[model samples]
Target: MGRPTPDYRRYRCTIGGEVYTVHLNPRHGRRLLDLAIATGSELVWATTWEQYANDWIAPRIGLPSLPVIPLTSDPPSEHGEMFKTPHVAAYAGRRPFVWFDDQVWAEDEEYLRVRQGLADFLLIHVDPMRGLTSRHLGMAHEWLTLTGFSQGS
Candidate 1:
């Protein structure tokens, strides 16, 4: 959900089509919150994990409860945008926003570019296997700085 553990140890396995195991931790959450504070960015849960992210993942990562993008069903995929793409764009509305997700695709980027109009947007794709890293955070921070989205700016 948020950061990896101190050693960044995590285990994931798929025992069957219906059964799986996953692990989570907190160090990254603190870094993320710090970044949010510095940038004046509001962090919201945009994962398929939904409210479950707030329930199960946030606490372990030391994050307070966050707003969730209500995703009850997938929007039509006529444009090949991922299921979350339309929902994310709608939730963002007219606000400039940066989104981090493992499933983001080029189609999603194009969709957002047109959908957001003049609103600034950034989408960073996280590698599911490696999870979030300092490099990802650095990129996000750098993007914020370049876009003049930080508090000091």
Candidate 2:
């Protein structure tokens, strides 16, 4: 007899045996695209872990394949400090940018401010539990407007 197939509804963590499931907010897709258009900001993917994002996360969230900010070399430390800030600052190269992530900290913001030195940068933090909301989008738009970085600027 063949072995039984495992149930897909829930997953058992190998380390802790804790069960978990995924909940996706479909509205984020439209919201993200709308924000990008409204802010005239190009969307790019920056993640600590890229493989899962490319294989699973992006499609479910309705984001198309985007240029990724490589982060494997300097992964996020257990203390929650971010490693992507420097790379992103270097990649943007004095260009204006707004980064949205759940893990940004005060140190990261200060680092960018000092490193970029006159570049327009906004670091918006989102709650991982709630995901992205309309309010966050509004803030991004406001920042761009305030900074005089509208569309083609």
Candidate 3:
């Protein structure tokens, strides 16, 4: 069966006459927690701009407070490279990890391809409109199972 899409709402926040719409998918949040439980995965929070992930995001999503990766002052690359990539890599060190974000693209893949000493890395880019889905979780579970990283492996 295909993955199910989560229910979401868009809330508009106005700041100094500028408006921004934030998408909130509570179902996706639950799915993320379920995925972590199913895969024996460690979910660490990392974001470039959201300072209230622990305070605001986690509570809304039914997640516990997680370790947040600190951001650096790296500028964006011409190919739209993510500024948080290096910080994530450094934080991961030689450990295997799975990254879920809406911003990763080709440039980010290229950046990861050349990094050495990483055991195994899976970068899943969720569609901002759709949020995280069951398919993504299934893929992560399969990867962990194949790599002998699943729970009780």
Please list all clashing residue pairs in model 3, or write none if there are none.
Answer: none
**For candidate 1, lDDT tens digit of each residue in 54-147?**
8767877789999999886865788777888878888878777788898988888887786545358888998776688888889888888788
lDDT of 3 by residue, 13-67 (tens): 5545766666667665677777778878788888853455776567666778888
- Cα shift from native, residue 70, model 1 (Å): 0.5
Residue by residue across 1-153, what tens digits does model 2's lDDT show? 122223212222222353434445655667778777876778887875455555555676677877777765766544334778777877788878888898888877777776456458888998766666678888888998778777766
* lDDT of model number 3: 0.73
lDDT of 3 at 117: 43
Ordering by lDDT: 1, 3, 2
Model 1 TM-score on a 0 to 1 scale: 0.84
Candidate 1 vs candidate 3: which has greater lDDT? Answer: 1
At residue 64, give the lDDT of candidate 1.
94
Computed on alpha carbons, the lDDT of every model, listed in order, comes to 0.78, 0.69, 0.73
Which structure among the candidates has the greatest TM-score? 1
On TM-score, the stronger of 2 and 3 is 3
